[model samples]
Target chain A: MVHFLKHNYQDKDYFFLWDVESGSLHNMDSVAFLCAKKRYDKTLSPNEEIEYKKISSKDKDEINAFFNQMEESGSLNSPPRVTYFKKNPDIVKALCLNICHDCNMRCAYCFAKDGSYNTAKEYMTFEVAKKAVDFLIENSGERKNLEIDFFGGEPLLNLDVIKKTVEYAKKAAAARGKVFHFTTTTNCALLDKETADYLNREMVNIVLSLDGRKATHERVRKCLDKTVKYEDLLKKAVYIKEIRGDKSYYVRGTFTVKNLDFSKDIIALNDAGFDQISIEPVVLEESSPLAIRKEHIDEINKEYERFANIYLDRRKTSKWFNFFHFMVDLDFGPCVNKRLTGCGAGTEYLSVSPSGEIYPCHQFVGMEDFIIGDVFIGIKRPEIRKKFSEICVLTKEKCQNCFAKYYCGGGCIANAHKFGEGMDAIYELSCHMTKKRLELSLAIAGIEKLYSINA
Target chain B: HIVTLFKSSLDKNHKTGCGECQSQSCKIHKKM
Candidate 1:
């Protein structure tokens, strides 16, 4: 499939085309864009006053020849092949330790059932956390650098486990000649100076949760404590920003149906002194009131477009910040295997529950059917690992015909299974948003490239 | 006119040699 988009940046018209299998980008002029679009859709007809309708027969043939040349160079219409599946034993590289299953806030759109994961509220003991580290090192297989994310209903609730886990992991990993890269996700509601200092000194990356503007954040992420308002949370987050200067972090927010104009939320984050930001669309059941429905896709797409323009304007100034979804690494994207298989949730990465029970990823923590094994015993179900190992674009029938298949890697399996029919089916809403984000990201990248060349 | 902006190394014929490599982690893959 030919994946291309027409965009207007600062009154400059441009077209961005993507080579699906090769993951390459080409910027096309209007003539080439029209010709390529027509090629992709044979019955496409231009309006009477349009430029394509006024093209000479000779010029049309020349455009066709150019397309043929591009096709011959394997830069257009080249489909991906189904390669051999590599299923190595004991190659897991990352673990998300859900240290606490209890949260301080009652976010209406929370997927973790208000941080309890649909179970009783609990905290991971130091022993379980220590075993999790040992489990990671024992099963890491020749991997030198390992990743451990202190995750949960708010990992700071179980502060002792996090501190002890980090200290133990460092000592154990040093003895085993393995390096640990630590990260954590927090709501910043319980962030104090002492913990903030400790996190700054220990963690490599921290994700601070704030839902953008005061009203928008207050609408969904309701703190249980009446006294702790949005301003209070923002103060704590800003303190982290002050202490953790230049360190990698993001102020992550979620937008529901209530806040379709989520661009304002992102801008609020940038204005709040947070540079790296990611405001994601909330995934909820259709029955839920706050869930983003099929009809909301268009408005969300427009919001993204508006945000892209604002992002471009900010790029020219000193106040610019990075938006995670809009950022793409052209120099070296993910490897072909990774691009095909996606995040490696079940195989390469696993989530450890408070009790040391292991699931595929954080999303699958409480589901009994998805329980592969515990950290102490290691992955017991090879069949589940095999299932995720075979999860690639080629294996998923719905993804085979999609233009954005390679970019998203068939999307999150948990969402597909929860929202769609099964793991093989695509979540249509998420897929639509993904395509829009990819298009805008490519357009921004191309526009910047042109600017640099002209300058 | 058409300008090729960036072509990734993960083309159809690109070889990762994942099977022979001792370390399974790629820097870009780890970001995901």
Candidate 2:
């Protein structure tokens, strides 16, 4: 019933995003969710607002005139009446601190390096880290409950810095009558009794990546001697669960198509012990597109279907994923943010490097051109703000026309900036996949509820 | 020409290892 209702989005009229300046794209829906009392306010200049109201209230001819005037002025602020999703930012949402550009593991698909920082070697000094904490705590207003996530090459490696910052954050949030939670998604290469105990005491929710079993995991992730990094990962996963005793600490893996034929690893992780599972495809860069040929797509889709059947039917306490789990879990609706729901780049959240340089996300860290701001001045500077405004064009052309505009939110600014695709390119192959995934989720939910299969 | 420019900009703006969101897919996956 829970899964069915959560995935059931037929009732939601609009999508909402909150505190976009600090909100991470991942976990955004949960973070930005608000009481329906707040309504969306379209951002428009006074003249544009007047024209929109006039067109909305006047006859068709007047509406066309106003629209033409808007087009001439390039002031397309008011979108025609659409489904409304109320977004009330009454409390603090989520904070993604790119604490450092450092990581312990060297995942092959890492894009966070230029001539700069792709390695898990560098870090932010205590000074910069402390300053960032002070800034947040000092100015934090209406931030009722803040879920702080540590992001980096490996946030665990910089444990002291985060522990220090968290001390201040907890006190600040408490002083403001707010709550605090800590979470991290790591490769699980640095988990030991000491580190695990510290994390458990901090009440940190962990997501350890184990892309299936040994062979598949080793294909991309490796250590000094090309050793499979599975044993320690599983050991730590089980150990963390036992220590924390919190079923919410998610220990799962991502599955790329190369391992479509493998379910042993999924079983292995479950055996190692993790209850929550997040099985997603290897969403490669647009340039690469996950190496998915047409046949591969069809084959993987079928394989995922088979895999999902096992996952759904299994009576085990631990969760296991075949492939279709991610696709079958989301509620497809317009994002909820009125100012910017599409891309959290430049506007809401910015990914900062160890040196205080900023990028859109961890994926886009330290690329010089995409540096929206710096730690010295802050992200609200005119130059950075200008950079942000320039990139907020997802609603430009193709994205506005597509029905999935609300559903897909015109993806990232960096990837689709080319391909003759502004934020509004016609539904790409990926968008098609998202829509298909939504339908699958709806079907699974409908089945689970109507047939009482999950009961 | 466009691909070169795009790649150059990506290299300039986006460090690798960041999620290859490329565009809408990243936010789309998260949003939905």
Candidate 3:
């Protein structure tokens, strides 16, 4: 019941104990770490047991009393009971509009299957885009700000539609006493001065795709014309960074087995003047050549530590940018709704395909089974909505036992449905990576806090 | 034996009422 994970930074002599149930973090000595592990009824490793034996009886009793006090304070074993927002359905707060399911590039690991989502290549019409915006406004309930993400094979492919959609959402929201926050994810293949200017002025955030280094990026992401150069794309992205000024943007990359040394890619993006960077591992079936497999988890885990060190190194400079996964603000994390139920996919958020059909999220856009409703009907399938609404750490049997349960919110439902047993099941591979990243995040936060305190 | 670095609970925080947080990282992930 004392759910906690003992973690330490690489080559650091100190250890940290994270009380998962309560989100309480502590800096502890090695003996206390091993002692807490044993007292929690967890079996210690041979080396840990050896160290455990070295603890004096008095010290052991003191640590036990401390843990007992924490337990008595309801911070150790008690997991909060979460009530699903089913009785009163959660108001939709965000939507990912698949503006155009057609891409100019051929990326091997693209989940959208070259932006078509394995469907007929299409673009969302102005009418459909307008309806999607209206759907968001109608369902947003008391929420003032609604989020609409311009997504696609490459959102900029339907640049005109994106602009029109933004215009429509802005006008519609203002009239209805609601505000819309716009975001777009692009390959930067079709980005130009005019489009960048338009996006900079309209979008609150933009995600630019660059798969790390040139070799790694080119290995998977290729232009249809074959004449486009990575340098050209990089130039345009850098231009956006400059012109966008203070508005948020990040260069996101996907690393496959072909690039296990993905930390170098984060460095590459940083070196290229991109401060806010995120390089994520590709999610592919193991049979695929580019897939990150069981064999590669160890290497990837080590890469995470390597990236953590580099992240800390950058923290000492003005060049530091927020790494997506490593941005762990312990004092101010996600709200209770998000912490318990994860990203509100079906309930509080939905995805709109080019034709206006609604799915649970962007990852489920083309999958027919996931289509809960269309923009016209507005969530017709209450049963499907109920299923999504029920998803949470408490509902997931595996997550209930996981130390990282609250942090990950039972992992991605899309990944669970695709790779695991079902929506309630956890994706083991992603779970492994999530735990590693969480560990590193805590270590980074602890190190920074200690450093600041010392200074 | 224990030096508490940071400790806070979801229930104790007043910001749990709304989704709006200045941290764009949360929004970016929510949108994703």
Candidate 4:
């Protein structure tokens, strides 16, 4: 079948055709699009009657020429194929170390069971962290570049271990002729001058959590005792800005149902001198009060539209700002081509908990069933790896039929499990939101293209 | 071909990648 997807933006229709067997993208004209769509829908056959009731002879000839060209390119042929990745134990690329299970703040919609993962609040010892690093290096195969992310209830809570781990990883990488990149995700509540200086000197990529406005951010992300104010967090953000200047650091915000006009948050962050900002929907149980419902999707879509407008306006004025998700290569298609799953969780990416147990991603840190292995033994159950490796959009029945399957990558596995569904099951709200976001991104790209051509 | 043309335009405007230094260096640089 000739698999392709179509969308209408600003009264202009666009079609994206894909050669499933070759994984190559083909540009489709209106006639080619109709032909491909009808073929996929089984309403038209290759050698069947040309329905010329709606088309003139000229258009019909054009359609026939396009169809013949596509056929010659082997775009219409359905080649038998299977997508699978063989287990290569030595190809670890990225590892997220759950440095500290203890957290200083008690955010309202924290999925990590209030940051401790519902387990005892503790910090990962340097020994366990060192082992995790060693495990990464040993399994890193021929890969020279790797990444280690400092994650936790708040990674700063275990700054000592992080410092040691970075120091060790640097030497270990040098000795093995590998380059290791370090990153940390912090709530910014604990970013003091000393810590900021250390992060700056080490060149660690920092991802700070700051939900848009003070009122909205405080409503969801608050201190355990509700004493740490938004001003305090802002001070840390400014401090990091001062120390790191423009080094790569992202100001990430989570927007729950409580704050649907997330564009305001992006604006606030931009006004606050943060250039790289990303605001994401809070991932919560579908039944949770904070979960984005069907009714909220429309409002969220409007917010994205507003956000896109503001983003374009900034570009027009020569102002510098980047909305994280909006930073997509519309021309080049989805980032991963070989993977069936998004983010390569259990396979390429692994999160090590404070006690040394490993899970697919950071979201699965505390979940026992999701535990794939431990630091000492290394990937205890290869079966779990196989399961995750085998899972792709094709394996997902819903996603197989989704127009946004290639882009969405079957959604997040952690989210699917949160809705009490299998890995292949994506949350309906996420699916809708993602498809809308992709559409908006394409529209924005379209507008930008027009401007560039005029220039 | 349209996508490629669009991508070339975007690249000409320097609106490409994640807008970060791919080198992953420590030195502070202005946002592009």
Candidate 5:
């Protein structure tokens, strides 16, 4: 019954380790385990909440046998009583600013009313951009690896700001004896020779947001001239890749349901010398312009799946950085299949918009309600961390109980809150997709590893 | 032997499901 001795471990502290059965389950704190050992002879019920007392050998064997069975099937014996993520510090990978809130092309599904179509010229001031930099410097001083991401109304609209921020960050990083990972998500509308040179020189990652082929891209991203920007975007895409000389530099892609059919586009990117692509389903929000149905998500997932297979098979992209890292559980070789499968949202790499408002990520920007803190004040004044802590404490319910919990951890906080589902909601379909995505990614990696001449 | 190919089996399955939800604009349904 006490095969793994918890006698030395503190009575109340939980242990997150593999058990004797080679299964991952949080078998209570030291006290509880000892208590279970004491009740060694009692009739055990895995679900029943009870205390301990010294018992017989037969009962001990029975209890141990039952626990092993549960572990074999990938289920948790009980809730997690300890949390490690709460104690560890986070490294700031990228801090994206809402530099240009006024894009030239009005995307059809944009949720913000103050968008290109509505003509809200809400550009970030140079001072606010400074604050974003300050936020990075101040909040992430402890870490050696850091990144500064430029976001948009078409961030190129505020090219001066992008240039200034990167330049400043480089100097500041040098001053502090740190480094920077400069990146951006742009519409490729402003991908000229000048910008391409600056990007390649600084090794800046240009994330082009084009859905797919000309027809597909034109369907949504439209300019004021009512012209489909597809042809222009494709032209720019070709130039950006050719000039960058490195496939990783030309990260042009799109977000939308229509883009699930990106095989042709994937082929194009592969052939054009620009590879390392990133793709995501157009995130559906309540305030979005279109009435997206479930069918769209299904189709998008399918499309993304097809695209993912092609890109991954060719080694054009690795899910480890962008999609899979967020999607899967590292140890599991798949996403933690539980309901709350996700990383430390507020706790890990945080987000700060142009207005000095702190959010969890760029995805959660613009939704004013999601703002957890403001720059003028600081993290101490905000309840964002507090709320996140409360959410993190809910591990045992949805996550610990489900088989996929460890692989997933917990999902995106925004998605959980958006669905009006508490963090404890039983396995979200995201759990399923996350697992599905990673399993495929690893499979691809294995196949590549097997046949690669380098290997 | 039952190990499923994520791209072919699971991912395609999820995409078809998401496509159905894509038309809804996420007001009533925002996520998978």
Candidate 6:
């Protein structure tokens, strides 16, 4: 009757007890964890009960109190409930506009069908871009703040469309009494002063891709001719820093089998004067050389630990750097409670391709099966929207029992499908890495709190 | 009551929002 999940880290068992009815998380120590595990599994052996009773009267009393509290809280007999969102297709608050089907650089791990979605290279026209913006604004329901992200092979390739869309979106949002926020993800290879200035003026949040060290970045993220140097990108990065200031930009990088010790890349990015750095793992086919193998997980775990320590050490001197992942609060169950899945993909959020095809998210843009609607028609597959809205940790059999379920939301749906797993399944490597990262983040957060208190 | 306990225990300055959520297109933002 006691629904809880257990995780073993560093040989210590930690349990998370969920109040199924109320969606609450209770951190439990090993003793209480074992007791609850037995209660939930109905496997309390005779010897185990005797051993539990003999764990000193004080400890026994504490465990009894914990049980009594759970019973009183009505969590003892409650079944786990899946979090569901009533799909309202009209309430779209976020739209990712794939402005360009062609990219300047040909990165090895370019997931957007190798950055062109395997189609003829083209750019989203002003008309299509404007229509996408209008669609977002019209369907945004009563929401005051709506977000439009300019995405593509390289959004900067179609800078004119971005500029025009922003101009139109601003007026449209103002007329409707709604605020609009624009964001863009760029490789920084083509970020000229004019583009940087324009992006700065518009206050567009920029995610700049710079894969740590020069060799690592060049190995995967290279020019079409494979002659682009890291310094060229670094110079542009510095220029964007000067224009956008530090707070408005993030230096995003990726790590793969090529760079397992990516903490060095984090340090490299930090040394390059980027205060906000995010290093991600390269998602590729399992057979791809860049795909993260199981053997690399241990080193990746160590890198996270090293990065956490470096992050803490930097904070002590008031460096004010933030590793994107370590910013989570372990005490908070999940990012959003409204949906059970990791993100609001097909429901609250949707992506529009350059030619006006609608997909669940950016990753599914060119995939035929995921096309949810078009710009002119709106969401055509309400059933698919409902399916995504219904996918939560509870729906994932593995996630329902995972200790990190609340933290990771059962991993990403697209990633699960990438590894030949179902939408409700999570990639095992991602799960392992996420759990390790969460553990490290928890440790760092604890130290950070102590340091703050002492300071 | 449980939500209150969880919230109070949380570091008030801690960011609970996922960075990938802002991207809208990225499902798993944090890669190891």
The candidate maximizing DockQ is 1
Tens-digit lDDT track for model 3 on B1-32? Answer: 57778775544442344654321224322311
Between candidates 2 and 3, the lDDT winner:
3
Ranking by DockQ: 1, 3, 6, 4, 2, 5
lDDT of 3: 0.81
Q: Distance (Å) between predicted and true CA of A238, model 3?
A: 1.4
Q: In model 1 chain A, where is the ten-residue run with the lowest total lDDT?
A: A81-90
Task: Please state the Cα-based DockQ of model 4 relative to the true two-chain complex.
Answer: 0.07
Q: Summing lDDT over every window of 10 consecutive residues in candidate 6 chain A, give the lowest-scoring window.
A: A80-89
Q: TM-score (0 to 1) of chain B, per candidate?
A: 0.26, 0.20, 0.26, 0.23, 0.20, 0.16
Q: Model 6: which residue pairs collide? A: none
Runs in model 2 deviating more than 4 A are A1-94, A113-120, A138-141, A225-229, A262-267, A285-290, A293-295, A315-335, A338-343, A380-429, A453-455, B1-32
What order do candidates take by TM-score, descending?
Answer: 1, 3, 4, 6, 2, 5
lDDT of 3 at A12: 69
lDDT per residue as tens, model 6, A1-455: 23445444435444566443443345656676666655666676787677666567676567767667766654454443434423344468788899999888878888886578877788899999888988888887777778888888999889988888899999999999988889889998788888888887885588899999888888888776456578988989878887775447888988889888898898888888888889988888889988888888888887786677677778667566888877664344343443244556787789998899888899888888899889988778877887877676767777665645556755778888867377867688888888787666655554555345458
Scanning candidate 3 chain A in windows of ten residues, the lowest lDDT window is A80-89
Candidate 4 deviant stretches above 4 angstroms:
A1-90, A225-227, A242-246, A331-341, B1-32
Number of the top-ranking candidate, with TM-score as the measure: 1
lDDT of each: 0.82, 0.48, 0.81, 0.72, 0.51, 0.72
Docking outcome class, model 6: incorrect
Query: TM-score for chain A of every candidate model?
Result: 0.95, 0.67, 0.94, 0.84, 0.66, 0.83
Off by over 4 Å in 1: A46-50, A81-89, B17-32
RMSD in Å for all candidates: 3.0, 15.1, 3.3, 6.6, 13.7, 6.3
Residue A56 error, candidate 1, Å: 2.2
Could you tell me every candidate's TM-score relative to the true structure?
0.93, 0.64, 0.93, 0.81, 0.63, 0.80
Task: Please provide, for model 3 over A1-455, each residue's C-alpha lDDT reduced to its tens digit, 9 standing for 90 to 100.
Answer: 44444444556665777766567677777777788789775898898888888889999999989878877765555455453433124578889999998999999999999999989999999999999999888888877879998899888888888888888889999999878889999989888888899889998999999988899889999999777899999999999999878889999999899989998888889888998888888888778999998889999999898888888888789778779889787775766555765677787878999999999899888898888889987887877878887776677677666767768866788988987668877788998999899988888898888888779
**What is the TM-score of candidate 6?**
0.80
